[model samples]
Target chain A: MNEYTYPIIAGITVGTALRVFMLRTDYRQYPTYLHGKIIHLSLGFIAAALGTIAIPSIMEKEFTAVTFLTLAASQFREVRNMERNTLTEMDSYELVPRGNTYIEGIAVAFESRNYLVIFTSFVVTLCYLAINGWAALGAAFVCFVISSLLMSGSKLSDIVTVELSELSFKGAGLYVDNIYIMNIGLPERQDEILKYGMGFILTPKSFSVRSTIANLGQRQAILHDVSVTLGVFRDSGTPALVPLIKRDLNDGRIGVFILPQEKDPVRAKEIISSVPVLENAIQMPSRKRNREG
Target chain B: MKMEKAILAAITTQSEKVTGSTAVFHCETKEEMEAVAANLEAILDGIAHALSDRLYIIVKH
Candidate 1:
């Protein structure tokens, strides 16, 4: 094979692989059918091809060709919009819908993965030009593994401690470790809640952690995730059955009350613990106060 | 003793005074909120069983 062709092949192959690696088919089953898979795959391949071609274009002193990358950036932004629109439409029908924040996160991730593909191909092409094809491929693999590891953000456990709290009913009031969750004045409803409901207390380790969990969006995301994993008990029009995360005003600890179709405390705790600490929710009150002082 | 019964009794006993205004019960926390709702629902069910068409709108703050 021609030396020029080897670099392009290495870059496109590795970059496409990296993009495919990031596209997931989880319980939500998003990006369904040909339209979902084909569009992204084609876009990713095009992104990879652009990156692979850029190095050769530069070597040939064809500076005008580099403008394509700028155009590609504008196109990728639309990819984010596409994901957001699709997920937003789907959210209305969800039993336990991913909140706007979580959907934003998902949309951002989809857009970022395309850029990641471009970066991977750029690295592979750069390496291929500098070294042999085999060495460049190996380097690209290492880069892929490193990038994948970096993609994982800090989980809730890193910021707070999640413990399974006792779900008890006091007459009509529900208490999850003295954090008065809510009252259920009806005996039958209270009985059902006690029988099916589960609770988790998130004790933030620091003031920052407390403030982060206090964000209403973050709490809603947690409830959304828990419901998705375990399933919600309520159907449409049953507002009372919606899972709630209540903040303890005194200490800032968050109390989560969820009545899942399947009562599983361990799974509930695990999902809460793994919830991504949202970018907007991380507040450092003590830090701010200290800085002011 | 149940939440539904409590709300029903509250409404039935105080129907003359309540008139059209909502009977708001403030529970310092969400537990109080839930308790009020459960009671209200039970009361509604009982009313329905008794073949009464008296309708009440339920809202939580």
Candidate 2:
């Protein structure tokens, strides 16, 4: 047909491919269901189409068509809301619920991914129209690299050192590396806890990271991730057999107490270290302190 | 006006130690008191917290 036909198809294909690559269901297991995958893939296709068409419209002097990007913004925002609602609804039934902060971070990631798809498509189409098809392919490769770099946030290991700690009972209170977790009055319950429980102490690498790791949401995210990967040894009726994180007020270290069925300390430590530091929970107090002094 | 935590019941060998508002279960011995507390904890879905050697309060959290 027209000269723009090949470029438009190429852009759409690359953009949609980027979306598929980004939508990978990893340990988080989100969008794993067929329907969920279908929903996202369809949205990705629409985003790619919207992004690709903008270049040709601009070339043909139809400037008004570019305004559709604004509509794309609102649509992607809906994707965020959809993700939030679904995750929040499912969180309640989880053995160890992923708190609001983690859910929000996931929702934000989903929305940003669509925007990245759009960006990829726009750049690819522009390259094809301005130069040639091979240039568009090169641009797409660069876009993939940039998107991946942007997508990966800092992990827990970057800011803190996770060390295995002894879980001990100082009278009724459970202690993880001198940090008091909670009180368990019943000997039977205490016996069960001691049998199944594991402890870890997370020491912040820097002064600024102390506050970030201490966030309640960040703590819950760690517990949820560990429980998901290692299997929680708890049921609905058993409130005492719960995982907890307590802070050592004297130092910036945190005590993580979990009841994982799989009692492999090495794997547990690895899982803890790999948990994503939630974007919403990050705080850089040192930056402000540096500015003032 | 929702109660996140409250003492549902107090199981104690020393009935004199706990008083007022909350229902108290006066038991003959420490073993009996623990048994009652455990049952109550499972029933009410609360945590049994030991206040003293003679006292245990089931608090909903």
Candidate 3:
């Protein structure tokens, strides 16, 4: 009777406090599929109750460490499950560069807030066991404190941050903001040159389009083809001229153009004249000058 | 052994769409694996829980 009393009280205290703490905190709001804290607390109470009832007939050393280890493993499993669930959810969002930093900080804050309570309860339980000699009441008290602290601390943090700046791309003709354009070359052979020499090639054989809604709002399904020529002068004794023509698409402001190595002045002029603002649209001379210098 | 069986049984009973889902377990030794298996078996033995559309395990040995 004496052995059972202390353990029973300890178990009850732990179980009740844990339940209360869970109810009072916002930990219940986090989305987790695993309910490990409940299991851990319940098991703690059961262990304390059993300890008290069997104390007189059993020695402290008679209790197997495997039992305690198993309980601890279950608790660990719950923690892992919760962490996995949270991470999986976060994977669905497009996060900015600094988003991960914010997540880490939130996780640290939660850990700091809960670690103190858990440590205190653990210490209290050890002290009670050492001083009260294997009695149910003392064991129960310890279990109650530990379980309560653990349950309250279980779900301290679970928030995800998403960012919106990493969605910028380039287009032709006009300096459109927040849009992506893909350039595909004609004759197919131009693909090898563009892919190996120019840095404007994209894999998977499709035009690139920005994935943001605010930029285009609606999808543009029309495909257009236009051509342009670039004039280059060789520094031989006299000026030797070379011309290059390229075919591309024009969408008012954004152009998806492809350039071939050979020159075609007539085709270039024809295609360039069709663009809305032809005078301002030509930029090859400036690009060439920059590259030469 | 038992726990793993229980968890597998539970997962099987909960959903049929468990093809791509993974289960991850951290085990250092055979003894640890056996212990985890036992606990898993106990939790999954007879209880029924709603299973996700797809659920799998990836053991992290």
Q: DockQ winner among the candidates?
A: 2
Model 1 RMSD in Å is 6.9
Interface RMSD, candidate 3?
33.4
Instruction: Categorize the docking of model 2.
Output: high
DockQ of candidate 1 against the true complex:
0.10
Local accuracy by lDDT, each model: 0.76, 0.94, 0.31
User: Candidate 3 on A60-165: residue-level lDDT in tens?
Assistant: 5555642653554455445445444564466344111112222333333333323322333343344444565354345445655654554332110111111111
Which stretches in model 2 have alpha-carbon errors above 4 Å?
A: none
Interface RMSD of 2: 0.5
TM-score of chain B of each: 0.37, 0.93, 0.40
TM-score, predicted candidate 2 vs. hidden true structure = 0.98
Model 1: CA > 4 A from native: A32-34, A286-293, B1-11, B21-57
Roughly what TM-score does model 1 have, to 2 decimal places? 0.83
RMSD for each of the candidates: 6.9, 0.9, 28.9
**lDDT of each residue in A103-192, candidate 2, tens digit only:** 999999999999999999999999999999999999999999999999999999999999999999888889998999999999999999
Output the worst ten-in-a-row residue range by lDDT, candidate 3 chain B. B52-61
Q: Model 2, residue A15: displacement in angstroms?
A: 0.7
- DockQ, candidate no. 2: 0.84
Candidate 1 lDDT tens digits, B1-61: 5343333322232234344444644444444444554566544442111111122224332
